[model samples]
Target chain A: MTGDAQTPALPLHLRAAILLRLLAIQGVWNYETMLGNGIAFAMEPALRRLPGGRQGEAYRTAMARHSGYFNAHPYLAAVAVGALIRAELDGVPAAQIDRFRTAAPGPLGSVGDRLIWAGWLPLCSSLALLAYGLGAGPLAVVLLFLLTYNFVHLGLRIWGLHAGWTQGLRVAQALANPLLRQGPAHVARATALVAGVALPVAAHALIGPGRVLLGSVLAAVAAGATLVTLLHGRFEGWRLATLALATFVLYTMVR
Target chain B: MGGDILFYVPLAVLGAVLGLDVVSFPQAMISRPIVASTLAGGLIGQPVRGLTMGVLLEFFALESLPFGASRYPEWGSAAVVGGSLFAAIPDGSAGAMSVAAFAALVTASIGSSSMVFLRRWNAIWARGQQRRIARGSGSAVVALQLAGLSADLIRGGVLTLVALVVFSPLNRAIVGTFSMSPVISRAVVVAVASAVGLAAIWKVVRTTAGARWWLAAGVGAGFIIAGTL
Candidate 1:
């Protein structure tokens, strides 16, 4: 990649240090500005070495500026770090850099929260629990979970850095990319699929044969009804109603 | 049997590290109850017990979407308390697991409230250092960051210690006092957990078109697979 010659670029060693520091970017989180101070602290190394020939004045200015209000999901903060440094080196005015900061965190946060918190963690945790329940050893379940999760977790940090540096502020558009969107959706679907299949078998294993047969028919019917209703876009109250019905049935049968 | 310092010290340290990891360090899902509790149980020579407790706690923990400024229960240290208590209970009865789980859930709720105080303390410290930080002193920023990390570390460690000292005994007593039949209690746990997991699935898939077909196919295939087995 060609480095822009308008200003001195961040050195490779310095970039490594910044990425390492980014891992602890919430160390100084406050209720007022969240990771604001931590972001400033993480950027301190890169800021100190900005090559401005200004006797460390550049470092002071950079620190004070980044210490303002900032909040974003930690994993997605890499994108901001990469772009922020690139823009600083490109001599993008402080006002413009500030504008980029304000614009980036919100959208990137939603994408990260949805992809990671809502989508990835639940699915991976489910798979791990399912594996554990199926007699997979504890170590195997933990390792499977860690590997499946980090594939995306580490991948995003590494990828975000490159994307933020090269794409600059336009990196927000990367969230809209179809390839990126499809991965989470696919995983979500796979999770639901495996879970749907696995739960009945698990119930059967846990319960007895006669109970399995009766429960399977009832569960299948209830699931089918619920699925149809959800697919038609009316899913809000159905979960509670279904649970209440299931409980009533179970209590009656047990009595 | 009470946890000796050998067990207690490392578990507290583990709680510190994992608890710090919740907000300050890697934020790897290891801070999760399933992983954290399992690790805690293994440290005390009860890996299976810890793992079982973790799986149960993970169900209730799933409802939490820890994003933005949301004040969600802290699970890492709390899970250690739960797992350790369950493992320490004399009998592995359904009542035992339920009591341990309840203790952990209460610890998590307390942990959530404590986080607000921690945040306020961090803010107070940050406010004290604002001028120096703005004055471009690298040491000031470094000091503040280190202070915050140290505070969170202590917060997690102390929380783990207190919950263990207090709730471990409470959990043991509750298990002794309660008298639900094992079969019924276990069945109820399984049923409620399955319902929660199902609801979580619905939240994930209700929006995705054609999800029902894939789910139906899964159910039919599952039944057939079971028959062969």
Candidate 2:
């Protein structure tokens, strides 16, 4: 045990500095991926076209630089930075940090990107929209969006960097799996519930008394019927459209 | 006009918070269009308009997720700018909101480039600190952290200032080009807003039937709420 080398701990300031550097890196990377010609998009296609030989290996190595796994999530990169800085400050060798940087980005970026962008973001934003439609104030809507989005983003980044790839992958997988499978279904159910509630609520909130409440009650009943019709598979796109049109006409005539 | 500075402070703060959300700070909810634009709108005195702007921005922002070193537009900042402008202007003109939204979109594009520059700057700073950091110097560590914060603050503040000044006058000019028609203006707003909602739903629909329900509910709810308000 005495003969084994000890790992170095990074100082607090160093960790902060490195985290900032990582943020810069993630931000620039994200911008480039979006505005540039998207080398990552082309990599898979180009890889399939390559003949098997030394040329393929060389192509593979070059492709590694633009690899989807490495370039994907920007948020998780912060965790890697934190980990590296911590390692360095604690007397862990610079080489170890370098190795971790090289290895961590690919896996974490791949998983984190898919989880945050493809899964959580869409889900949360959809919910926020639902709330907004229900007459939630702009402040409430925005605050909820920020609260949900940042918690996931920053939490993952910090955890990934500190706990390393394994923990990050586990966390991402837990959340993302549910999203990929049932997120859409849940969104739909929630949306219907909100719609049913909102029509009446909005009428009450915006329009005062009498006819407004009557109109809202009628609309709510109609919405409930539509949901049931939809669930029963009796309502196709055209039918739903017709129903909406009829509702609009009825609402107009009544008002 | 001196009172205008108060308006600008919140706008600047919004920019800073959103910019931080993009990379430096907690990645939580700040980037969402609903959150960012509404906050901007509230700061400017029109919450409903802000919410509307936020929804449109959110739709357009569907494609943006910070992955790696890619050059993506900063949607959070862009939405704030767009939302604030739209909310501030009266409801009778399409051109004002259109110009402001377009300006914000363009500003986001430029912001992507600025992010790239900042990255390179960070890399240079890191390289310079390699030896000192390797030697475990505490002073070098503090300097680097301070540098990053200062850079971010300046980046956000400057971007917001430039966008507000340039787009405000541009919005007025654009609005002046045509007689303001309330019906036509509202029509334009509704069209843009609907398109955004539709686009977002389209993406969600590809995943599950639930998205369709959500979409229908969202649209119906929005209309009802807007009508009531």
- Model 2: runs farther than 4 Å from truth? A1-101, A154-255, B1-10, B134-138, B193-229
Candidate 2 DockQ vs. native? 0.10
For model 2 chain A, the run of ten residues with the poorest summed lDDT: A35-44
Clashing pairs in 1: none
lDDT of 2 by residue, A1-255 (tens): 111233334345544544444444433222223211122222223222334422454334333333222343556554443343233223344454345545654555566655666557765676666566566777777677767766766666556555432232222343345543454365445534443333334323322223334444444444543453444333222223224423432343344
The positional error of residue B61 in candidate 1, measured at the CA in angstroms, is 2.2
- Winning model by lDDT: 1
Error of 2 at A58 (Å): 36
Worst window of 10 by summed lDDT in candidate 1 chain A: A233-242
Candidate lDDT (C-alpha), each: 0.70, 0.52
